[model samples]
Structures are given as C-alpha cells and as structure tokens.
Target chain A: MLKSRIIPCLDVNEGRVVKGVKFQNLRDAGDPVELSFHYQDQGADELVLLDVTATRQERIAMLETIERVRQRLSIPLTVGGGIGSIEDAGRLLNAGADKVSINSAAVRNPDLIAAMSARFGAQCTVVAIDAKKQGEIFQVLTRSGTTAEAIDAVAWAARAESLGAGEILLTSFDRDGTRSGYDLPMLSAVTDACSLPVIASGGADSVAHMVEAFQHGAHAVLAASIFHDANMTVGEVKQQLTDAGIQVRNEW
Target chain B: MIQIINTGVANIRSLQAAFDRLGCTWNLTVSPEDIATASHVVLPGVGAFAAAAEAIDQLGLRTAIIDRINHRESATLCICLGMQLLCESSEESQSAKGLGIIPMAITRFGDGVKIPQLGWNEVRPLDNGPYDAGEAYFANSYRLETAPDGWGAAETDYGGTFISSIWRGRTLACQFHPELSGTWGESVLTQWIEGITC
Candidate 1:
C-alpha cells in the first residue's frame, strides 16, 4: 500500500526562502537548499518550492537553487509558480524538479495542462487550484488569489484530471494562513469529485487537522506556516498520523 | 570514467549531480564510441518506452550497449524506465523492444490500484544482498513480473510485491530513482561505484 505524504511548502523569492523558517540548528534560514534539507531530515515525505519571484532573472536563480537543493536531498521536489508553457515546465524539470505545478496559467489556458502531461508524462504535471467560496459556489482564483474566475472549483478539478493532470494541489483562499484547520467541506468536495490524488493545502493548524484532511480523502497534506514558524515538526506530524492509524513513510 | 547514456528523453543533470557529490567522474553521451570505451555505463531514461527505444536505436547505442554489457565486464546501471528497457519488452507501448539482457516482461499495475505508483515505499533486499532494506522513492505505473535468477533482486510492496532492484554480473538496474532517493540512495550509488572500481 502507498503511504500518505506529508509535504512542507517553501516560498522562494529571488532564490531565497521567504517568511524565514525558525529552526534551532539552521545556520541560514534564507537559503532554500539548507531549509529543504532541514525539512527532509525532519521526515518530510516531499518538498514543494514555489518560485514566488516569477521574473526572468529570478526564474534562473530559482533553477540554481533547485540544482543546489537537488544535490543535497533525495526526496521528491515539486516546483511551481509562473509555469505558463511547456518550455517553462521543461526548464524546471531539467533543473532537477521531480514535478512541476501549474496554477494561474492553467486556469487561463486549460490546454497547458494537456501539453505538459503529453510532453513530460502525467505524473510530472500537477494542477494547483486556489478556490474561494462565494455565496453558494466556489470560484477559482488566479494571479495569486487577486483575480477570481467564474469556473466552478469542483468541475475544474475533474476537468484538469481528464486533461491528464496526475495530481491536484487544492488550496482554500478562505482558510489560507488562518490556522483554524483545513476547509473540510471544500476539500472533501474536490477529492470526491476526482479520482486523482488531491493534496490539501492552505489551512493546517495542528496534527489533528492533517489527520482530518486525510480522512477527508487527501492523499497528501501540505503546510507552510505551521512548519515555518516551528509550531510543529515534521516528525511530530508523522508520529501523530501513525498513531491515528495512517500509514506514512517512516524515516526514523 | 562513467558514461551516462542520454536518450534525449529527460535530463541527466540530477544523476550527474549525484555522481559529483560522490566525487566520481562522469559524462553524458549519446555516441557509441564513448559508451564502448567507458568502464561503467549508466542509462537514465524517462518518457515513453517506444520513444526511448526509438531514440536508442537511432543513436546506434542499442547494439553498442548490448555488446558491452554482454561481451565485456563493464558495469552497467539502468534507472527507472532505463531499467524497464533492460527487459525483453514493455507493455507501455507495443512494438517497443528492450535490450533483452534480462529475460523479463514489464506490465502496468492494472485496475484496483492507482496507475502511477508514486511516492516512497519500503524496499527489502533479497538473498543476502549487500545493502539493508530501506525506504526508497518510486514513480512508475509498470513493473516486472520477476527478476532473472542469479540476480540479487530487491522487492518492494505496493499492491503486491514487485522487483525494485536487481544485480547480476556487472549489470544493475532499479525501478526507483536512487539518485533522487536522498542519503540512502546516494549510499547505494556509492556502493555500486565502489564495486566497479575496487
């Protein structure tokens, strides 16, 4: 049986990890490579790096950061942010990213998902959806949540999967950075709508929240602030999941 | 020097980075001459089996690789799809023929389980293998029925037990990506390199 994955997401700007990570023995919290290695040592099943800085020059810098990080760690690394074309996905995959996530661009051009999957295989293409709950419907947001589209979130997830997206990174704008818990209703809707693996992102307050996400049908749970602030360690989260009878990759 | 066969399917940079960390000299080559002269060869592949097999044949590397691994004592390591390419053929694409060095057929994880068996899983070494059983990262939908006899086969459980790694004579192949597996993976590569050099 395949174990559920616990991933730590790092936002990188100008090749440096933003929102400084607090680790006791970490010499430089700004270095993405060091931070990734730190998280891997803490038993993170995988790492996700979002190139927040999408400029051409910064993209090159992000590639260099990926190479450095790839050299040090063996866990799967998924890179996202500003991937608009097959060329963009190619550059990242060649730079050593095991998978590339597509978000805003995917919403703008649905064919981009199919193209990437066709070129790099579906396993390498991940579709990230940022959905915000409106009156009675969930609206898909783009441009880092500044723009909202009329597309239904649930329907979009199913469409993305049919278009060859191997995985879905679902983030709830309503719950992001709130630390309350995952948006269970929204997560369950998306997971139930698609057979593809859904990675529940956005709000993750505690270990219990992760277990709940898993119960809600999430194949993986991704948290950034909780890990960045040192509110909890990856080892602790894995232990909690194990105690809850969820199978996780046992690193320790 | 180790020559990594480039099938133009995916990047070999990560594999190169792995070798660099171990202080090993390696280069990416599609030329048969480089492959013929090298003491060690690593074939790293991705994408479809038909496309990759076509690339190997077009580059004239199929004959060169088979001749070296079968005739000479040069150590050869195949990773992921490259490992699948060592068999008689694959179910990934019809009309795609493997190197035929290993007498096995590759097939996909059928209905019931997820297609692409992604993420990390525990690998158990068989028959007094050098390394201990450890967790390794895997990302493929297809698998081999059984590893050839006399090969040090290592199995990993997904829906059922499958051959994850195999070592026979100078030929070694792994269904998982050892270069991207982390510390344990790096150690495995180091051991393979040492086995060839020392």
Candidate 2:
C-alpha cells in the first residue's frame, strides 16, 4: 500500500520564502522554517524548498535555510536549485536534507545522477524534470521552466531512472499556475516508461485534480499554488483523496 | 571512538553528521581490524535487506563486528535496514540471512499499513518498564517481529504491533532513522551512548 504523497513546495530566495503567481511577480510568503513547520502541521507529506534566486548568491543561504528547516520538522525535505555536483548533494545531505532534486544540472551532466547515487543511495536522489507539452510530445525545460529544451520528457525520465535516480518529480510547465489540472498524459507517459516513483507537479487546482494525478499513475501529487494560496490545505486535500477512495497517508 | 560499520548501505553520511552534531567522535570503518578494535559500532543502512546482508558478508566484517558486540559490552546501534539485520531473516528477502542477534524475523506490513512506511512514526515503548515513548523517523517496507524473549521495544500502531525498537542484552536497535528523528532521536542516541557500557 503505497500512499500518495501531498507535498507543499516553497520557493526560497535569500533565506525568505517567496510565492509567485505564475513563476513571476514573487511575493514574500514568510520565513523558511516557519513556513515549513506550518506545512508539516497542515499534513504535508514532504516539503520542497527551491532556491529561486540565482545560484551564485544563495548557495550558503540555501544551505543554512535547509538546516534551519531540518531542525524544525522530522519530515522529508527535498532541496533544489544550484545543486550541480555530488559535493552539493553531499553538503545538503550533511545539512539535513532527505533528498536533492536536480534540474538543469542533471540534464547537462547525466553522469552526476549515477555518481551521486553510487556514493549516496538512489532513494536519496531525485530528478525534477520540468516539462511542457508541445504538439504530441512533452519536452523537458531547463532553467526553472524559462528555457524550452528539445529533450523528450518521457525519454529523459527513463534515462534518469537508468542513471540511478530513485524518483522522478515531473512538473508540467504548461499546466503550472494554470490550475486547470496536471498534464496527466505526460505523467502517465513517464511513469509507464520508468519503474521509479513519479511525483506529479503543477496544475492542481482542486482536490479532484490531485486524485486524478494519482489515478493516472502518479506515485505522488504535488501542488504549490493550491497549498500556498490557502485554497486547499494538505490536510483538506488528503481528506478529499481519502473520501474519493484514493490511498493517502493517514497520519495527518 | 565509535566505529560505524559501512556495509555498502545508505545513511552513513547522515549518521556521521549526527555524531558530529552531538560533538561525538567516530570513524566509518569497513575493515575487520578497525571494527575489532572499535569500542562502539553503529550499523546504518537503507534499501533491500538481502542486498545489505549480502554486502555485510561480502565485506567480511560481519563476524568481526558481531564478535565485538557479543564478547564485550560494546555499544551497537543498528538503524533501519541495519536493525532488520539484527533479526533472523526477512520476508522481503527470505533467502537473505540476518545477524540473528535477537531471534527475530522481518515481516511485511501487508494490506494493513503502507509499504516503505515512509515519513515519521511515533515510538510507543512496549511498556516493559525502563523505556519511554517518543516520535521516531522511519522508512522501510519490512518490520521486525521479534520472539517474546527478545522483543525490546514496540511502536503503537501499524501491522499487528511490531517491534519498532529492540534491546537485547548489550545490542540496541531502532527501525527508525535516529539521525533523522530530530530531538527525540537525539535523546534516543544519547541514551544509547550513555547506558551502553563498553
């Protein structure tokens, strides 16, 4: 019985939590530790802390923020942004992160996944693929969804798993912030191609959307706008899923 | 200094980090000689039990470390898959043998609780006197069902009241990741460090 996880993602910049409407016009949400504890209390399965700022300035700040958040909760924390090397993943793991999500760096250096997974375990590594559907195929995007890459999402996900990525956090750039629902076709394509767990991200407006993502083969569903805007708390979303007969962790 | 036996498993870095955070000095040893001279041994692992157990045998430190645990009152802390190794065998890998220090076997959670029981779980001390209950971190698919003679600790719910933590003679174990368990984990580690006399 693998429960579908409900994650609340927080975009961190310069030690502060920021929430953007659609990856633009960011507004300060709160402190990293405070927001993390709040999300955990509200029944978030895990917290994703994305260092939204440019990599150069926020490296140390991001690490410190992760450490502070780690001190506050015992839940799994996934740190992304500027993690370009095994040393970066090691440093983050040392600072108390459960998993590290690699985006542009992973796509650029596919061997990093294998090397890190060899040093650390595959379960400790996750590849976050930002994808946007074009024509019939969804393509992987880099630079936090700003750059449209020509790589096929499904193929890249399979490659990632082969390279020792334990899980795939697939985000739908087209559906991001639109809240219409997740790009189920894209998620299903990736999950079918790879045996690893797939966490569906983006375009989850209602509780039903989250359920649909799981039903469509997502191991877990992630929604940032819904959770951040207070439209639907993680608890409420889990409750809705449970009522809909979808398996979700009952702890919260 | 305590020696953390690395049997080709995960969580060693985090364990080392925890020790560092506690200002405790320790060494990560995969050698038989280092384990033999070590005052304390911490076994930290994750993933499949069979693979890890095979790794322990392959590394050839199994007998040496176990000898250290049995011969002296050395502090031995096994976390997650390492804790599972204390049992006799696991259903996850029935062919894979365990260290058999506690006369227990690993069983699946079944249709009851979820597999890979991910995230945080509370430790409800088996009420066998001396132990206290606290929240602990866990991430595993199989559980250790100890025989009555060796059941050290148990968590409250999930899968027919299994042993979440066990204490048999000098050997101590917890299915949870103490390094990831926060303050309660630190307390558990402290107790292990202080109570176990090497």
Interface DockQ of each model: 0.56, 0.19
Model 1 per-residue lDDT tens digits across residues A1-252: 678999999999998999767877789988999999899899898999999995799889998999899887678899999998899999999888989999999998999999997778878889999999998778999999999899999999999989988889999999999998888998989987887788999889898999999999888999998899998889988998899999998874
CA deviation > 4 Å runs, candidate 2: A20-29, B1-42, B46-76, B84-198
Candidate 2 lDDT, tens digit per residue, A139-209?
88998888888899999998998887878899999889897999989988988888777889989899889
Local accuracy by lDDT, each model: 0.86, 0.77
The residue-level lDDT of candidate 1 at A132 comes to 90
Top candidate by DockQ: 1
Best candidate according to TM-score? 1
Query: Runs in model 1 with CA error above 4 Å?
Result: A135-137, B196-198
Tell me the tens digit of each residue's lDDT in model 2 across B1-198.
Answer: 878887755655557666776778998788998877766778888767877888899999778867876664666788888888877888977898888865767887767443446555567776452246766656666786643463456664565666787775556777888776655677778778766432
lDDT for residue A67 in candidate 2, whole number 0-100: 77
Give per-model TM-scores. Answer: 0.94, 0.73
